[model samples]
Target: MSTLQQLLREIDAKQKRINKQRPLEQTKIKNLKDYFKVGLTYASNALEGSSLTEIETKVVLEDGIAVGGKSLKDHLDAIGHGRAFDWMWELAKGVAISEEDVKKMHVLCFQPSEGEQAGEYRHVNVVITGSQHNDRLPSHEEVPALMNAWAVGLPEKRKNRHPVQYAAQLHQEFIVIHPFADGNGRVARLLLNHALISQGYPPVIISPVFKHEYIQALEQSHTKPENFTAYIAEQALQAQRDYIRLLRIE
Candidate 1:
């Protein structure tokens, strides 16, 4: 078997153990959810240049207080992304993922800063700064049609893939679409976790420390998508380990 296939098998084994503990997750995972809200909020924003430390993010999100000297947008991102993640947690329990779900997540994460443009698709072309092939992104005019087709075909695309691969594909594709004006990365990560969480897998938290490697994988995705997919599987493996640790699954 390929190494990723082997890793996936191990992930499946861990997931089975976690599934056995699912009844207690309603309580046990509740606390972990709050913990991950802070962790995910910190990592996702930091990857995008937010200045809030993890402690600062937790302070802004849970304590309802702003950090001493952070930018207003920084504080807002923590608060807003946390709320969107909350909604995504609820959404994961549902039967399907819809395009509206994607837009709503963008709105929740960006409305505090982006206003009416929150859920709206971009009207002008965007350039993915630092990417080698920015032209690979669809034009703003193409987003609506592309996203519609994507959401419509999601069920079929998800059918044969392993959950981790599906989640990674979801993340990669959403990032490529670059649907909304801002917050695409955050929303894309939300979509990734939504797929994973709904399937009894843990959310993959890409730490800021891995920022360079992560962006490189994403940028290279245009040519070698499996490289990115494998990168995501590695992240999923770590997330699965952390999740099992929190669940005390020995």
Candidate 2:
């Protein structure tokens, strides 16, 4: 078996153990969700260059307080991402991901701040700063068809691939498309977790501290897709461990 296959098996075993403890107490579930929302919001925004610290993100998200000296855009990013995180839970309960649901996540992540472009694909081209791939993203006119095809084909993809690999492919493909005018990374992360959560797996958090390595994996993906797939599987395994620890399950 390949490394990806081994990782998938490990994650599946852990998930089976987790499932036995399902229907976690309301209080425990609430606490875990609250903790992860703050962590995920902070990390996802930070990966995209938001200035809010984890503590500040928690304050801004939980208390609605503006941080001193922080850019208003940063605050909005936190608020918007937090809302999107909540919406992700609702989306998680769905049977499959849809193009409309993906657009709704972009809207939740970028609205008010980017009202005109929120939930909308870019009309102009953009480039990733440090990527070595250099391939042009699908143009504005092409996004609708590309996205529709992606959504329609997801069932077959899920059926053929392990959930971990499927989640990684979902993220990789979405980022490659770079559909929205902005907030694509945040939406992509949300979608990644959406795929995992929909399948009874806990969401993974990609720390900003690993931003360099994360970009490297994404860049290498163009040549060796397994590199990125393995990276995502590792992160999923870490999340499984974290979930087990959080529930104090042996």
Candidate 3:
């Protein structure tokens, strides 16, 4: 069997196991939610070159204490991302995604650093430093319509595809649009997680250690989109395994 097929099978098996335990204990839900708040904040920021460690991220979010030797922006990124992640959960209680949902997450994520432009699409074009294939982002003029279309089409997209594929499509398409002037990657990840969590899948954390591979997959998305889709499935399978461990599921 192909690797992607194997990963999807494993994911399906674990998801079935998890489904049998629906409505997990409140304590387990609370603990896992808190754990991922820090983990998602740290990893998402780290992928964008922030220097905060996972412990430091927790301290900033839980204790509001700033670590010395780290720039203020690092603390802001961590805290802001935590706020955004929380809002993602807020939206998870519902079934629809909207342009406002995407914009609001971006605003919360970047409000500390660039409040004025927080949720606003860029009026000026920009380039992603060091990127080659994935940098051919949509023109600034196209963002509004593209975003509207994406949000409008999601119900259909989710209806016909597997949850992992839907999330990957959601992630890849958002990155290609590059809607916001900054912090797009973090928000894209947030939306991806939102899509997964709403479908009862564990949130995928694209660790910084695999940032290169992740980016390469995204870059190749311009051509062989299946490669990127399969890469995302692999991440989802890993998350499923970890989630099962947390629940101590037999």
Candidate 4:
């Protein structure tokens, strides 16, 4: 088997172990959700160049205290992402993803600051700053049809692959579509977690520390899909380990 496949198996084994510990207590679930809300909001926003530290993110979301020197846009990103994270949980309880659900998450992530463009697709063409790949995103005119096909095909995609692989593919595909003008990266991560959580796995946080490797893997995805899938599998495994240790599951 390939390295990516092996990593996927390891992730699957860890997820099975986590599954055996569930129907986790309600309080435990609440605590986990609260913890991840801050961590993920921080990491996801930071990857997109938000200046909010994890502590600041927690303070902003929990204490509602604005940090001095941080841009208003940065504060709004954290708050908007927090709301998007909560909406993710609600979507996780559903049977399948929809285009409307995806747009709603984007709206939540951007509405706090960019209210008008909240969930709207960009009318202009864009470029990824450091990518080696030259693939062009679908034009704005193409987004609605492309996204509809993406949402409609998800069930079939999930059936033939491991959940982590499915999530990774979904994420990569969403980025390729670049459906929204901004917040595509944040929405993509939220969508990825939605798939994983729906499958009974803990949500993975791709730390800012891995930002270069993460972007590079994505840049090389067309030529080397395993690199991207393996990166995601590694993060998923780490998430599972963290969850297991935090809950003290025997």
Please give the lDDT score for candidate 2. 0.90
Clash totals for all models, in order?
0, 0, 0, 0
Tens digit of per-residue lDDT, candidate 3, span 34-133: 9988999999999999999999999999999999999999988998899999999879877578999888998899886897999999887878776775
Candidate 1: Cα lDDT at 192 = 92
Model 4 / residue 137 / CA error / Å: 2.1
TM per candidate comes to 0.97, 0.96, 0.96, 0.96
The parts of candidate 3 lying over 4 Å away from their true place are: none
Per-residue alpha-carbon lDDT of candidate 2 for residues 140-246, written as tens digits (9 for 90 to 100): 78888899998898999999998899999999998888888788889999999999988988899999999998889988887888899999999999999998897
Q: Tell me the whole-model lDDT of each prediction, alpha carbons only.
A: 0.88, 0.90, 0.90, 0.89
Model 3: colliding residue pairs: none
Question: Could you tell me the lDDT of residue 163 within candidate 4?
Answer: 90
Least accurate 10 contiguous residues by lDDT in model 1:
21-30
List runs of model 4 lying over 4 Å from the truth: none
Q: 179, model 4: CA deviation in Å? A: 0.7
Error of 2 at 122 (Å): 0.9
- lDDT of candidate 1? 0.88
> Candidate 3's error at 33, in angstroms?
0.7
Instruction: Give the Cα error of residue 232 in candidate 1, in Å.
Output: 0.9
